[model samples]
Target chain A: MKNTRIRVLIAKPGLDGHDRGAKVIARALRDAGMEVIYTGLRQTPEQIVESAIQEDVNVIGLSILSGAHMYLFPKIIKLLKDKKVTDILVIAGGIIPPEDIAELKKMGIKEIFTPGTDTKEIVEFIKTNVNTI
Target chain B: MDYQEKKRIEEAKKQWENRILNKVLPQFPERKEKFVTGSNQEVNRLYDPLDLEDFDYLADLSFPGDYPYTRGVQPTMYRGKLWTMRQYAGFGDAEESNKRYKYLLKNGQTGLSIAFDLPTQIGYDSDHPMSHGEVGKVGVAIDTLQDMEILFDGIPLDKVSTSMTINAPAAILLAMYIAVAEKQGISKTELNGTIQNDILKEYVARGTYIFPPLPSMRLITDIFDYCSQELPKWNTISISGYHIREAGATAIQEIAFTLANGIAYVDAAVKKGLDLDKFAPRLSFFFNAHNDLFEEIAKFRAARRLWAKIMKERFGAKDPKSMMLRFHTQTAGCTLTAQQPDNNIVRVAIQALAAVLGGTQSLHTNSRDEALSLPSQESVRIALRTQQIIAYESGITETVDPMAGSYYLEKMTKDMEKAAMDYIIQIDKLGGAPKAIEKGFIQREIQNSAYQYQKDIEDKKRIIVGVNQFRSEEEPMKDLLKVNPEIEKRQVRKLDEVKKKRKEKEVQEKLKLLREIASSEQNIMPPILDCVRSYATLGEICDQLRAVFGEYKESIKI
Candidate 1:
């Protein structure tokens, strides 16, 4: 029997309550045959990483709308590295500047999906990167 | 042909068909059916006489400010006075927010809208352990009567209408406002403002709730009763659909869920033996102005018509003001993009235009830089100017309900009304908003809609400029507001000094009484007012209630 479940953790970092995009992405990922774990609003970087690590997810998708992406993404990257969770692909979505995208990529962010990046691309990106077994 | 060439050809043909056939083919039935936009995908569409079968125009789309108010709630609308241009602003400490408020007033803004930081919103003081780095991060942080006093330092409460975006701790915030007014020598009856005491949506969409549904509802009804008696000019509760829409609800869901929640408040008030007409006349609403131009307008019209009917027919509200649906609209912040930040100005203008066309009583256009951070002073001024240009330059506001009697608008309005009524029936089946919220029915619907919209964006079904399409590598926004961490230190020190200087005995007595009243079936507002008057810290008052009510842990479902 083929193990066909794709696990995705939709985490919100910092104090932004603007989770419409995050929630929508979570739903879309779930509908696209992925098991999505949503750590609801006001989650710290530590909390999100812990949830992602414990859930042992294939992909960690962080949504930051509070303009804390610079501080938050780096912290999450450092935590994932400290935990030696290198296999889990990390991505981010929300109001990230173009200047910071290169830095985020350097820090191991696989892809940055800003506003208007289609749900299908996200689904496809996850499918291609993460092992479905 | 090679595979790549064939694939390119097929894609080109598909795009061509989509552009041409979709735009042209209304003449022939075979062509028309193929070109019809999906009912669910469109949310609204153009209609003709065929769409309004069995319709009587005079009975339905009456003149503006008339009964049912399908056209509008006011006769002249902007012709008499333009919708109040209120900007929802607050950040840093109370003093900082106060300065911003004064600036907005000087900049020709007609009303004041306060955005409390997360700590104050969830009933925590800046110095509280749980508040940590979140103090005055998103909005202003008010810890005690001192902070409230500083927030309204120079601004007279009786002079300008204020709207505070607060929910779970709305009663406490309202009490603080009243106490501040008293200090300013303003009578309660002379005060005018709105407290967003709509907790049902807090549970369903926004996640700043402290207590569970039952106590929250009780607290809200307490304000309804208190305001009806004391503050005649005050809008005690602002039934907010703005958060619901921002939470990813469709236009129909936003209207229905908001109205259902409104009904829940009325039912609770009526059960408390309060007359509907007395409190209902002062009730106001807040809605999100999303990207869908025509659909948003129709949704607004349907909201007015449906709410009027619900008020007069269901609640037996006889007064015209009681039946009127007055709402404030904030253009969707979720639609803004950080990729090409400057493009957000255009998006905001379109959304603001929709709100005006939809007959909103007030409007707040989101600053373009808000997508990346809290707007800078320059960006905020530009956002205000966007509204100014529309009110002065755009001739769309010359007529009330400009889209009235248009076959497409009427048909879409009726369709939206029917869809909303369907959701209301579903909520009714689940025993109204509170019970439905408890069961997470509303949350689930919002989640589903949110998910579907995301999927559409991902699937390329919906085109969002500068994100998936019109990709650019250059940075657009050069400046964004960056809050220094020292603001928190200053705020904490201010809170500590206030605590040290105040009468501890009076504070303790007020808090103790507040706890007792909170635990009992009595109104929490009076005790809350006592605590505010005694200068009890926000954390102290909230801690007392927290001990009585216990904290609510959200049941996460995605």
Candidate 2:
């Protein structure tokens, strides 16, 4: 079981084309030996959740830069629940405010990485918490 | 070893050991501690000369304006003339943006750089349903020749160089500009400006792209061909690394990827049977000047040298101007923090100085309040003053490549050049930028770097002043410029009027001819000009091309 690979999905939801941060996270995860799935920019909530389900990823990381996180994150969480994929961990990052992080966490967002968060910490956190196959 | 040398080495080693044991070891009691810099690079306790062993002065790090222009592009650089200080100004209607342009020109700005709103960039009229909330939010709203007329109302076409940051609908906007100049009784050959027609980066980094890559490339090459023959003074495509850097690429990544894109454009034009020297001299670049002052400077130097080598050695360019890499620099907008908004003023000033030191031909400094909203008039003025202070008060402009001979800087420039060359080789292996982009290679690399930076910031390994440290208890928010919702309504009405007043039959005939030419191998510029002159809205022209070229859906990869 320890020899099994951990699959993760990195997605961008809504109309934001700013994917530099999202792409960076995906590459770091891939380099860290995770099988990462990246959905390109301008993804709807349904598109993200569908891709996550299809990829069968253990964790889902959503990146948003357009200040549309409030509307986008909840939809993803709800879709995961509806699709009976509650076991999949959901995390987010971007220009999210501290106050919004609390509400997102309430809606089952496990972690939030903002501007200053480092790659090593994100990898370490995912490695410790994610239940690899 | 000689007696004096041996003694000196031993004493230096002993001092270093003593400092590490007594000072450094105590500071980092935990051996697991990792040191990180603002640019997210893990820094060691020290960098020795051994770190830059392969550095050569004449071969790798040449003098300013010489072959392999690593130090600077021009022989005199800023000593002769400082970089054109052009602030990115545009918002609301064309009238408002025009006023700002006039204000900047009156305040001693050397050039004008326009920032069109989302509606204009995407080729939609202000009245379009899709453009409901976004008319004047991001930048200025330009719908037709009328709006273009207002945008450059009083600005003379002959004197001041202008740069329009538009892609996708770049052809339409350029046509509108030509029409405006025509109305001013100025010849097209007399006009000098740049159009941000680099659509490849729009796909890779910025998302303001309209057409698919193939058609976009065709449109860009057409401009290159047309501008070379018709508008001699115009810069057709500003192959941009600015948006790529803003999108989170490391400095090395930005330089390598931008050059790779530049190579692709040259190849595309060459395949179209155009001589490299004919259009290559007109090819320009736009790069982001980030907070890493030395690194940014090194990146710019490395860019010039690499571009020169590639042109002379690879593309077989004969003209020296064809090999020269002239770029416009914009201070990194992403580096500006919302935490300490006022501190952004200092950050921009430092970034602007870096651009000047790096030998940029032109530059635009990001205003302090840009992180929250469009800059207020006062903030924009301060941003302009930052460039002025650097030009007059700072003695940095007295010499060309002021830091040319520094051991650390020269080594860094060589290292960056080598790194960029290696990446260029890899991209070439992957069959150039378009292929690599299709495979999501460049996008993945940028994403990886961005993620690593974010993670470092989260773990407190990287300290951003006001974010992870230097906590301010109570900071007041600065007033940001807010666009009224009614501005969009006004734009919509204006677009409606333009549509109503324009000759409907003539517009239809021109558009039909435009679509035919777009489908064929003939240059699309002539038809585009006709459509623009006939006042066919941006969206109408773009929709015709979209119909021919089809929209691009990006392939996803993790």
**Which residue pairs in candidate 1 have backbone atoms (N, alpha carbon, C) closer than 3 angstroms, thus clashing?**
A118-B457, A118-B458, A119-B458, A120-B458
What is the two-chain DockQ of model 1? 0.37
Per-model tally of clashing residue pairs: 4, 18
Those runs of model 1 whose alpha carbons end farther than 4 Å from true positions after fitting are A1-6, A31-34, A42-46, A67-90, A96-112, A120-133, B1-46
Tell me, by DockQ, which candidate is best.
1
Candidate 1 TM-score restricted to chain A: 0.94
Per-residue lDDT tens digits for candidate 1, residues B438-537, read: 7889988887877766656656566678886788886456777776668789999998998899999999998998888888888788999999888888
lDDT of 1 by residue, A36-96 (tens): 9999877777898889888988889998765557767888899988988878888899877
Candidate 1: TM-score, chain B only: 0.93
Quote the positional error of residue B331 for candidate 2 in Å: 1.4
- Poorest lDDT segment (10 consecutive residues) of candidate 2 chain B: B36-45
lDDT of 2 by residue, B344-378 (tens): 99999989988988989998988887755578899
Per TM-score, the best of the predicted structures is 1
lDDT, candidate 2, at A57: 82
What is the lDDT for B252 in model 2? 88
